[model samples]
Target: MQVLATAGHAAHGKSSLVRALTGMEPKEPGPALTGTAWTRLPSGRRVAFVDVPGDPRSVPAVLAGLAPAPAVLLAVAADEGWMPQSREHLEAAVALGVRSGVLAITRADVADPGIALRQARERLAGTPLAAAEAVAVSTVTGTGTAELAAALDRLTGRLPVPDPDAPVRLWVDHAFTAGRQSVVSGTLGAGTVRVDDELVLMPAGTRVRVRTIGCAGEPRDEVGGVSRVVLTLRDAGPVAPGMALVAPGRWSPTTSVDVRTRFGEASGRLARRMTLHIGAAAVRVGLRPLGPDTARLTLNARLALHVGDTGVLRDPDRRAIAGVSVLDVRPPTLVRRGAGAARARELASWPDRPDGALVLRRHGVLRRAELTGMGCAVPPDAVPLNGDWVADPAHWETLRDRLAAETARHAAERPGAPGLPLETVRLRLGLPARELVAALARPPLRIEGGDQLAGGQPEPEADGLQ
Candidate 1:
């Protein structure tokens, strides 16, 4: 199955194109902005259409539709050529990293599509969709619909296969009651959801069980990525839009994140307060500039955000938008005077792509699971210490030196004492576990009584020193 979101201005024939391609009427019985729709293509491959609103006031809805989709179906009317909403929709898609999609020139029977086609190509230039195939279609006359479907088929074929074994992070776009059960639907970007599988509702951390799964309007035991999914959940006491269902203990809900702008500048030009739109959730945020292009956003509410996730920051007062890519979800505290500038320099050195080794190097040491939870792909060559801890090679060496120094200092200060206690050493070094301290103990410095860290030899008695 494949999912492609519709991006264009309202009344620009986006819904008409969807209706022609799916051969199905609008299920919501109102404007396309009301809800999402799904159907099977002629090739037996199911496709879901997330009809998004093009109005400026509905920018959040537009982002929600584009956030989870891997591709898009961009529409432009032949009579209107190019409109303001068309550019906004295209920018939104680009912001969300949507690459592969087909361009549909609607209302071709009423006006020549040549002008609109050229205009779209000019606007799409230098974007991810620069090479997208265009088809002229008139839903009124049923002309070019077949070609449009064929183009979509080709687009689906080119979409990269998603990892089915990835952790589940289903952003709920719609939630409603059915009979006596609660149902939530969204596009599953990755991972698989199965019946009876336990998932945690993020931010609130409430656990819920999947009673049933529906895909392409059919009941299924399990569903995989790139497919629209509806799950009937049990114990999901007040599920709502903007909430996400995720694998338990695999995600970290954070209220602050560091991001780099991909669209607008993030310097003093941006407002101090803005709205962040990611997946199906929108939250008020406080923006603090770390650099000309980088900033820290403090969200009003906690969100299960990951490194490399793309989102939009909208300043409603200024009617401005900026495309942002997350750099760090758990950034360090900047309580000092020059800390923000120092952090900006550190972020400038980071690669655009997420790297686990970079994270390990920055933090010196971290649990392996914690790195994975941050959406970092741990490098195969990462140095693993005792237990679940992994450390940077250079950082581990530094820790050994620090331990020896601390032990020597303790002996000099308290000559009669056996040595520094292992627990104390762990605390002094800020190590998360005591096993790490034991692992750092070398030949000369050893754990003598299985509890106390001693130097090579015991210190002389106080009277012997006299």
Candidate 2:
């Protein structure tokens, strides 16, 4: 299935265009409860259309549509040209990594769409959507809707398929009870869910069974990601919009995360109060800046998330204020002064390819299984230190340099002293364990008596000095 979210100013014909393109009539009583519409392609492939309200106050809704949809249909009105909501929605889509999109100049019959198309082209220049094609469309007259559909088809073909074997992390957008079962609907982004699969509800950690699965309103035995899914649960606890349904025992919920963000033209530290929108969930949060593009978020409640999830940090008004790429889903707390800088340094040194080197640098040491638990690859050249901890070459060099300088200084201050006490050395270097210090002492330095390091080759143990 292919999904394209429609974003534009209110009354710019987004809903009308969707109805005209999909042939799916809007629910007569009101907008659909999920605020989404669907259609089928000639190839029997399904296409779902999510309409993001153009009102600025509905930024959260807009972000929800942008995050899950592989592509977006940014609508502009021929008569209204480009509006503030249009720019806001486009920026949000880009922030959330929407790379493929089409510019729909709606209501072409009302005015010269040439002007609107030109303005959109100029506005999108140098942005992620700069390459997007502009299609003049009018729902009333049914002009160019077919061409827009073709564009969506081509765009959907370019999206990379999610791994069907990965852990399922469905972001629940809506939940309700039907007959004797509880049903939850969401856009499944990864893995597959089958009937009788035991799933874990995150943040609350409740277990439930999938009695049945539905896709595009039809019953199915199994459903893979990159499609809108509806799961009927055997036992449903207090599930809500912001919670997630994940693979059993594969994920954990956390109240804080560390991330690197791109704030665009908006500058200054993030406001104390902001909202973080990831997938379909939005939560109020506290922001602590670690650097220009780095921060630590303290979420109001825990969320089931991963290390690489893309999130958007919005201002108090819920506008797209910053785009965040999560670095660490479970980060240590900052309790003392200068802790922020220390954390920032760690983030700066975080390896692009998370590996044994990163684990060794971050925690200074780790068990073999701990490295595997973090999904770090053990490099072929990795050298083991102590029992199970691996030593990063760079970190080892830094430790060696510091030890050499400190030892030299200690000997110079107290001429004829054997060496610095191991405990004193540990305290001076802020090392957590004596084992770490012992692991660092190599050639040119010797540890003796289990408590002292020989500063200058042990002075040959002057005869009978005892």
Candidate 3:
């Protein structure tokens, strides 16, 4: 299923449009500032609205939280022309690979509609957005609501679709309390999620019971197909936005990844090391160019990114300039000098043993925390030294014993640290991908205070990170 996101400058009539489109108010209570609102609209239509803060810092969270390949709605006020924040949202959307969208020129009665349209065209010129159509709308007058909804229905076909029989997975973009239980809201990416379906929260993989599923504010038994859903989870714990409530036996967090990213006109040359933001997770990656169409990079920090996940590249200031989609995911060792045999051999021995520094030269499925919990300890190193105590045959037997002991000890003692990134461990071990992963399944040791891991924490609140 596709996760559609609504983003524009503040007060572009997005909240009203969302209500008209889905008939649900994601903007809860009191007066609405519309700061990154997400909801599962009525009729199994899942829409996540990032009501941007109009503040410059909020742009990163809006762009980063966006579901990959989801439909985008660039709402512009007809009377307001192209405001500063509006342009920022537009560029961020374009960077995320949003091609098909319906431009809603709101406040038509209050302002000149044509002027806004012209400004939007100018801002989006030379991009795919220039070719798409627009629908004029007014929340007060109730004008053009039907036309915009129809256009959205047509655009839904382009968003990603998951197998209906596949396990359910959703990025919890919004979480709040309705009454007695914790509720999570986001676009359903795939499969059918129904009332009382048992679910698992990833990294921790804790069991959560489902009490009800609300689609577009109405209680329902089931929902799918680009629909928004608010699920009352039994074991909500500290679950928040960016957390994936996935069907059992379906979710895999990546440690190494092969991604394809496109730089924007304003983007400078992507350097060797940078940070990547996806959903609610962020990590600094060591970037390596493979070709014009491909890239081989390592996450300096850690995350369980997946194949087909959307990620945005940002500068140190946290400003996003480009977005990427994962094409492949493997072990942290895959961040090899080349995607070759030698790299594989070196990374294979990594997991179960201690190391000085681990680097995910590429992004892959294994979660960094789980990987690290496998008895691997990392020494202080700003970069993934790719150091391995087991690399030498003499040290192999000793390291092997340590790996076994660590995995059993940690699995029983700590269970798992959802906060630890698997990438951090892989890079720290500097072991071959195969070895590092095997230990991840049943880690070799327990991890205490993180002395060396970076980018291991998955900050769910994008606003807080800002």
Best by TM-score: 1
lDDT of 3 by residue, 1-466 (tens): 3455676787788777877765555553223233333433233554555443455656545754454436677789997888877876776777666777778999987988999998888887898788767989998888888788676766665555666765566766567654456877666656788887888875466778888887644788888745666678764677655567766645455556666665452222676677776665556787765545356667654444445556677675545466676655553344445564454344334332223244222222223343333212233322221233223233343434544444445445655544234454455444446435333322223344433222222223257656
- Please tell me which predicted candidate would have the highest lDDT against the true structure: 1
lDDT of 2 by residue, 132-162 (tens): 8788888888888888777776777777788
Whole-model lDDT values for every prediction = 0.84, 0.76, 0.59
| Model 2 local distance difference test score | 0.76
- The alpha-carbon deviation from the true structure for residue 420 of candidate 2, after best TM-score superposition, in angstroms, is 20
Model 3 regions more than 4 Å off: 1-3, 19-24, 28-53, 156-162, 176-181, 265-268, 271-273, 283-304, 316-318, 331-466
Q: Candidate 1 on 1-466: residue-level lDDT in tens? A: 8889998987898888878877765443212343566766667677888877777788777888888999999999999988988998988888777888999999999999999999999999999999999999999999999899888887887788899999899998878765557788889998999999999987688888999998877899999998888899866787778899999867768999988888866556899999999998889999999988889999999898778888888887776788888888889889999999999999887765568888888888888888888888766776778768888888888887788679778878888888788999999998888888878787667887788888743332368656
* TM match of model 3 to true structure: 0.62
Model 3's alpha-carbon lDDT is 0.59
- What's each prediction's TM-score? 0.93, 0.78, 0.62
Model 3 weakest 10-residue run by lDDT: 452-461
lDDT, model 3, position 122: 87
